[model samples]
Target: MSDQELFYLLALLKVDGVGDIMAKKLLTHCGNAESVFKAKLNQIAAIDGVGSSLLKKIHDKSIFEKANEELEFIKSNNINVSFFQDENYPDRLKHCIDSPVLIFSSGNINLKNRKLISIVGTRQITSYGSEFCKKLIEDLVPLDPVIVSGFAYGVDIAAHQFAVENNLQTIGVLAHGLNQIYPKMHKKYVAKMEENGGFMTEFWSTSSPDKENFVRRNRIVAGMTEATIVIESADKGGSLITANLANDYNRDVFAVPGRVTDKYSQGCNNLIKTQKANVLTSAADLIYILNWDVESKSKAVQKQLFVELEPEEQKVYDFLLKNGKEILDFIALQCDFPIYKISGILLNMELKGVIRPLPGKLFEAI
Candidate 1:
């Protein structure tokens, strides 16, 4: 976009009542941010949700001053700007209604035809969660997925580190502006992270890493990826919020199952119990569910040879094997497992590579 347009968009965002959704609607109605300012009061008010207060806010010239100052920071710092409608904007994120109208980024990041998955969880990550993140990324190296996270402590940082070690692109979506980093202790890793991947944020130079901004940041994490995996979480945390947003966006959600007694495992266990997330026992489960098709037959077969099934799962597998291809409900009925319970079993079986899902909710043993 032209400098003039960028200036106007920045100002539009600064308007009190205008947010991403409203900005998009106004942009759609008025053609551009420049035009939104030029449009008459009656014309602007015609659009739904464009209230008198908002129209008055649009007229306030102070927004322009703030926008101009931010523009200078962009020019001086060499910050890359991505208009939501631009080719450079993340494809999946553009589909989210609340995605930022403009994003500021710095790095050598590339997203062309790449698989994107988000790993999120508690800031107080445990050893189990750490190892899981490492192995998951290591096993996924062949696919070379772009790992996206909040750039915080625990699971987020671990995901980024694993991606970097594996030489895969990684992105750390920040809660604050690019001008500064939060959790000052993490500053040491910034240079290295920016070398291969980099940081992205919707906040402008003036914005701080406020508590509310982190919640807003979670939406971007969930929206911009094909799937979201919660490595570990307490009964309540921001990662669970990201998982919920992914579910809201109709994206796949996966949670690592842990023993019920583990404090950090409660959130994930509850997600699985509520059927909000698929049981993520291993990287293979993610690959199978997302249909990544990144594994070789030899590698897959090798793993399948060691696949151990629970007695209940074995019953379902044997039933599918004898029946050739059977509907989901029929398998549940034949196995004498409730439909809800059978779904999880089938998902686990699919993860084991013991069965493949067919069209019309059918399953056939491999």
Candidate 2:
């Protein structure tokens, strides 16, 4: 984008009540941010959700000052700015409706045609979580996937370290701006990380690592990646939030099953039990589910051949086999089962690799 265009885009974002979605809407209507500002009030108001108040806010002159300051920071720091429609912008993230119109980054990040997965968990990392994270990254190294994480404590840092050790690219998504690191101790690792992969954020230079910003940051982690894995988490935490956001985005979500008594494992277990995530026993499970490499024989398929299925599961499987693919409600009704029971039965079949779940609650025999 040209400097003039970038200036207008920055100013457009600074307009009160204009978030990513609204900005995109205005841009779509006016063709560009510069036009959005110059267009008559009636023309702007014609767009849906473009109210009188917003039109008034769009004219505020102070927004231009803030935008100019941020623009200067971008120019001085040489920070790479990704407009959502640009090629350098994360492809997967572009599909998310709420993704930022502009994201600032400082890294040698390359995500084109690459497998990106986010590994997140509790801040207090356990030996089990750490080891599992290492092994998972180690096993996945052969595939050369790009690792994405929050760059926070616990599984996030561990995943980055493992990826670096394995010589794989890893990108850290930060809650704050690229101007400073959140945890001061992580500063030492920054140089090496930027050597291969680097940090990304939607926050401006003036933004701090506030509590709520982390929650908003989680969406980017979940959105940009094809899958999100929760190595460990409590029943309620940011990791689970990311997993849920992944699910909402119709992305694959995996959780490592742990002993029920473990506090950190509770979130992961609940995610699995609630059928919000698949049971991630190893990298093989994710590989099979995502169909990353069709040539590789999935152990899951081999196991499914010898797996014994319960009678209820068999009935549903037989129905799907005959019908090709059916929605969840249809499967429950046709098989003479309740919705709740069918859900659990299907989940069990999925874990067994006897059936695969598709978008829109559709399921089919595999």
Candidate 3:
């Protein structure tokens, strides 16, 4: 897109009642944002969702002034703008119907042919959540997946720090614009994060990190990644919202199981119980379900070669091998192990690298 086209797009986005969906619809019908403004009122009105009120808003001349202001900001800041149609945009996010019309980013960012996964959870992270998050990212180092998070406190910052320490790419999906960092305290991490991955946001320079903006920010974290992992969350929070958005996008969702007594585990436990997310005991669960190739990284999959299954574990493994995937109850019944004992047996099997767990209490052999 040219400067004139970007200017029109910026102006179009500023129009009242013209959101991402509406703007996309108008742009498609008219061929471009500039064309949308020049096209006949009758032609645009003929399109779905275009109303007399919206048409009147489209005629507002003040929109150009706002667009120009943002355009100038972009030019001066050296920020990179990615239109949804551009190849530089996130691949998975493009499939989402409500994805932003444009995403503004900074830093030496690259997403081509990379495996992207989001790690999100409660802002008040616990030792259990923190340790599990560390181990998960450490184990996934071989795959070189890009770690994405909201760049908030707790799991988001932990994921970024782990990724950076491991020399892996990491992206911070900001609730506000790239002009400033939220929480102010996180400014210390800006230099290192940008060195490896950097920050991205849909908001322009004029935007602020408001309460509602964080909710809107979650969708990008969920939409761009191939999968979402919730380390810990209470029964209600932004992490759960991100998981729901991931499910809505048909992307795989995973949650770490925690004791029912723990308040932060409630949201994750609920997701598993409702079959909205897979049980993420280890990184292997995500690797298996996503079919990420570990062949080239011999050390990563070498454990499976020497993995020795016990009698009960072997029985369950054989059943899964022959039957493909089976629920916990069915596996326990077929293997003649009691429900209480089978749970431990399955956990051992998972640790042995012989089998993995899935959503809905299903399990399968490696």
Per-candidate count of clashing residue pairs (backbone under 3 Å) = 0, 0, 0
Better of 1 and 3 by lDDT: 3
Candidate 1 shows a clash count of 0
Which ranges of candidate 2 are over 4 A from the true structure?
294-366
Report the Cα lDDT for candidate 2: 0.88
Winner of 1 and 2 under TM-score: 1
- Candidate 2 per-residue lDDT over residues 62-85, each given as its tens digit: 998988999899889889999999
Model 3, span 23-110: residue lDDT tens: 9999899999999999999999998998999999999999999999999999899999999999999999999999999999998899
The whole-model C-alpha lDDT of candidate 1 against the native structure comes to 0.89
- Please name the candidate that would achieve the greatest TM-score relative to the true structure: 3
Pick by lDDT: which candidate is best?
3
* TM-score to true structure, per model: 0.82, 0.81, 0.83
Each model's lDDT: 0.89, 0.88, 0.90
Model 1 ranges with Cα > 4 A deviation: 295-366
User: How accurate locally is residue 79 in candidate 1, as Cα lDDT from 0 to 100?
Assistant: 94
Pairs of residues clashing in candidate 1:
none
